[model samples]
Target: MTTAMGAALRRIQLGNALSAFGNGFTIPYLFVYVSQVRNLGASTAGVVLATLAVAALLVLPLTGRVIDRRGPLPVAIAGTVSAAVGSLGLGFADSKVLVVAAAAALGAGFAVIQPALATMIVWCSTPTTRSRAFAMQFFLNNLGLGIGGLLGGQLVDPSNASSFVRLFAIESAMFLVLGVAVATVRLPKAPRLGDVVPAGEGAKGGWRSLLGDRAMVQLCVLGFVMFFACYGQFESGLAAFAVEVTRISPATLGIALAANTAAIVLTQFAVLRLVDGRRRSRVVALVGLIWTVAWIAAGVSGLVPGAHGVATALLISTYALFGIGESMLAPTVAPLVADLAPARLVGQYNSAFALVKQLAMAVGPAVGGLMAGGGMYGAYIVLLIVCALGITALALRLGRRLTPEQDNPRLLARRSEPVAGSAAAPAPVACSASH
Candidate 1:
């Protein structure tokens, strides 16, 4: 990477870390603030929570097109602005309409930022460095959230409404900081929609063009199951399961969540080393195997029969195992998305994948909650186990469809290097992210 690009990436990472720190202060408390503090009731809190996903679904279709046309920097800035206003608004909102509206803005902003920031990272890094770039982003995100959650927990007071407002204020400020940090970045020259193809190409058939890529479509399917089987359950389904069937305490559940973040923070770099240069599909498949084990452990936690200590251990391990799998995916799935995208449509592909993630997140919780809530604990665990296995199968299938370079950029990079005693090595495969 050039010094300029390196510097730019650092700025983005720092801003992201700080922004995540701010988010940590509020994420765990939003439902409580709405339902209890504002006296909006549980149903209203549910609406507020659902509004985030609903708003993301409503706005994401247009996000990619905006990023493709206006560029990621401006789009990223806009996202931060929207999120900032929403965050600040949440601090002061007392009524249901005000709270839900603020949540919609916050959700829409966050959704826009996903693809916008991803496209920025793509523009800043080469194919070889892309994995590490994404890995670092995931690392910082988890790390920031972990640290923020820790501090926020210390400050939270169920009896004190002002404390919740303070948390939201900090989150809002961090979004503004992210905006400033991104606005100053000087990226390497990259092709926009016009430069990569004709001026109207993006508009003419952007979504159609993306859907036309067979590999990308298959990958989206894989992406949905991947998120559904794991992240989708973190707060809702998994938390409920831990507390109910597993009979774990709320405090223990918090510990389990901490363990998950701890696993990711400690293992992200190590997992990156193991996955680097390997086929991304294989790495993702490995994550599926790891999570399959996690879900089975989750199932066992409930069945362990009066061994409270044993059941708690199993539940925590279940979360930790999922964290390990997440660390692996950090370097695998996202860079592959970038590699699969056409240069001009990187934003489109990123947004589409983000949309898939949102859909899975929305559905996964509903299903998990219903099954778990309806005395279907056995079925809930079984369903997740099946989804985990599906990840492995879908990934291997997608592997067959990727180009050599797209599947394993490191191997291609090695091939392009001249041998020690030879004039040159074989030319690198043509497939590469056009950053």
Candidate 2:
């Protein structure tokens, strides 16, 4: 790569890392604050978080349109500013109603950030290099999450609201800083809608066109299920399970999450290089199997002698497997989405992708919380089935839709070749919020 290209890539990576840090810095604490400090039940917290997701879901598609019409940098600037304001509001909230409102604003800001960042990433690289770009983004994202968890753990004082508020204030400041950084970066102009030739032109289409594509739809469905299984374990159940079944302290749980983050950061590139696009289906299937086994082992670890340590190990292993799976899934999925989408409707395609995932994010916690409340075992059982089903569905769908040619590494390398008469060359679009 040229020095200029390398510099640009580094800048993109830096932007992504900062964005990830801003996101993670406040979120772990937000959940803990809502549940523990505010004295709300797990299910109630889930509902509140889910409501924020719903707000994101409502706005996410519109953000895609905005990115298509305007440029990515402007949207990113708006999003970061909004997120900062929302985080500050969340810090000041004194009532449930106010908290939920602030959370919704935060979610909306995130929704705006998602597509703009994604489009920028997509625009940055050739298809072959896009996977590595995404892997870097994913790695930084997890690393940031780890750092945030450690920071939150150190900062949180159950008896002290002042400390909690102060941490949130820091997070708010970080968001504003990130927004400014986004504004400083140079990005290519977005393509005009009329410039690109629409794919699947004969089909009656709007969102329906994007949704009706068999492979794209199946991928989205699988994404929903996969994320539902993985995120559910952490968001709704882990802390309670640690306390009740493993007899571990909140601090230990925080440490374990930090460990998970470290594992993600250290191993993501190695895992990404290993999985590569040609083997994505197999990799995904293997990841599902690993996750299922991890969950089962986690459940049974509770029955082991020295249950706390065993359960912690099992859970950490589960997260490690998730990180590996995510490494593979994140890179491959975007290229696949781009492949399936009408070239002219990149915004719609990106939006639909974000929309489905956000919808799942909205629903998964509430459902998982309900099952977990029944029993930790019940929650694991539900997650196991979901993961297994998602794997099966992804394998079958991709097997049918993706030909040997599509899966061929040589063909993938040729992805940067422009479709004849297409409006413009395809760009590397990374959907950052997909994390």
Candidate 3:
């Protein structure tokens, strides 16, 4: 049984890694492809990327509903196929309309895929093992991202537009193959609809039930802020900063990204093993602090005029530290989301979490760019302040909600024990309506 469990985990991890690789392949070069190759300005490219985030936010609720009804495997297959089609179309698109359409399609597909993937991970593990399972997924995802970034840097030659287009074609093929892979795998049946009994009563009351829970609400808020700050630094600002502030060649930038990815991949399991169910909010808070410091370091490094090599090294180290914090925080957040969610609305709960993140990713860049106009240091300072505030908020909220007794594993184990004469509760019904 243990061996079988391990094998199942291995399969899921491999699938996640492959899926993430396919998903990440285009991101490293997307802005460059849009701006330099397509002749769109940086602001325009940012808007295009933001459009993807908007699509994701708009699509996720509907996708979550579909996953609740049809199960994750079918949704995963559809999402992967859609992503492939979109990416392939992107290769052929010359006009802004076509590009935005393709980007929207890609974003929609990814949005559909995320909730299903997360649901599958949850389904495959016991609560005790969920954090580690997610950690493994995160590790492989980051590793694949690093590898994809490195490969993209090599593949995307500005002098040869054909080469860049070919890379997109290859990315399209990978997505298609991954879709098939997901389709081939057998997944567990989804929980029955309407199975969850809400703490309150009324139609559409499930949402109110979820919102009424202070802990869950706070978790969602923390998630929003964390992603808002992190994405602003890593996704929007990091590459541009590397190009402008550091004199490192594009190849070296890729290496530095690879190093950041390596830190996430290698350290995730170790961090997961060390942290487990204990001090989850504290761990998240610490991650925020680490990220803030990393941003500060990166900003400070930029102030070292003309020492581009040293500055670049410091910047990479800063990103590496951010990666480490992310490695710790990412896996922890999912399980907490699951735990805090009412049993009946897990899909909705997960979708809400994704929504917060998508919203953050969508809006963070424009704000970051505005602050960063002064310089990289200005951007870094803004990020640092955001992280610090986010951490403080999370700590205070979590501290008030979680008691020392609840934090004690032995106490939790005892609390979880069913009363001697209690009837076995029926499982919550899964709602199937499209969002």
TM-score of each: 0.95, 0.83, 0.83
lDDT of 2: 0.67
lDDT (Cα, 0-100) at 372 in candidate 2 = 63
- Residue pairs clashing, model 3: 192-430, 193-429, 193-430, 194-429, 194-430, 195-428, 195-429, 196-428, 196-429
Model 2, 1-435: lDDT tens digits are 234444555665676676666566577667667777777656656666776787788887676556655667788788878777878887787677777887888888877776666666666665566677777777777776667656776877977777778877877887777676566556555454564435644323556666667777777877777777776557666545555666667767666666666667777777776767565556667767767676675566566646556767775666566656666666666655655655455666777788877777666666666666877555556566567656756765675776554443446566656789977755443322210
Q: What ranges in model 1 sit over 4 Å off? A: 192-195, 202-204, 418-435
Candidate 3 overall lDDT versus native: 0.70
- Stretches of candidate 3 off by over 4 Å are 1-8, 36-47, 190-203, 238-255, 306-310, 374-376, 379-383, 402-435
Clashing pairs in 2: 118-430, 121-428, 122-427, 122-428, 122-429, 122-430, 123-428
Worst 10 residues of 2 by lDDT: 426-435
Which candidate leads the pack in TM-score? 1
Model 1 lDDT vs. the true structure?
0.89
On TM-score, the stronger of 1 and 2 is: 1
Task: TM-score for candidate 2, please give it.
Answer: 0.83
Q: After aligning candidate 2 to the native by TM-score, how far in Å is the CA of 268 from where it should be?
A: 0.7
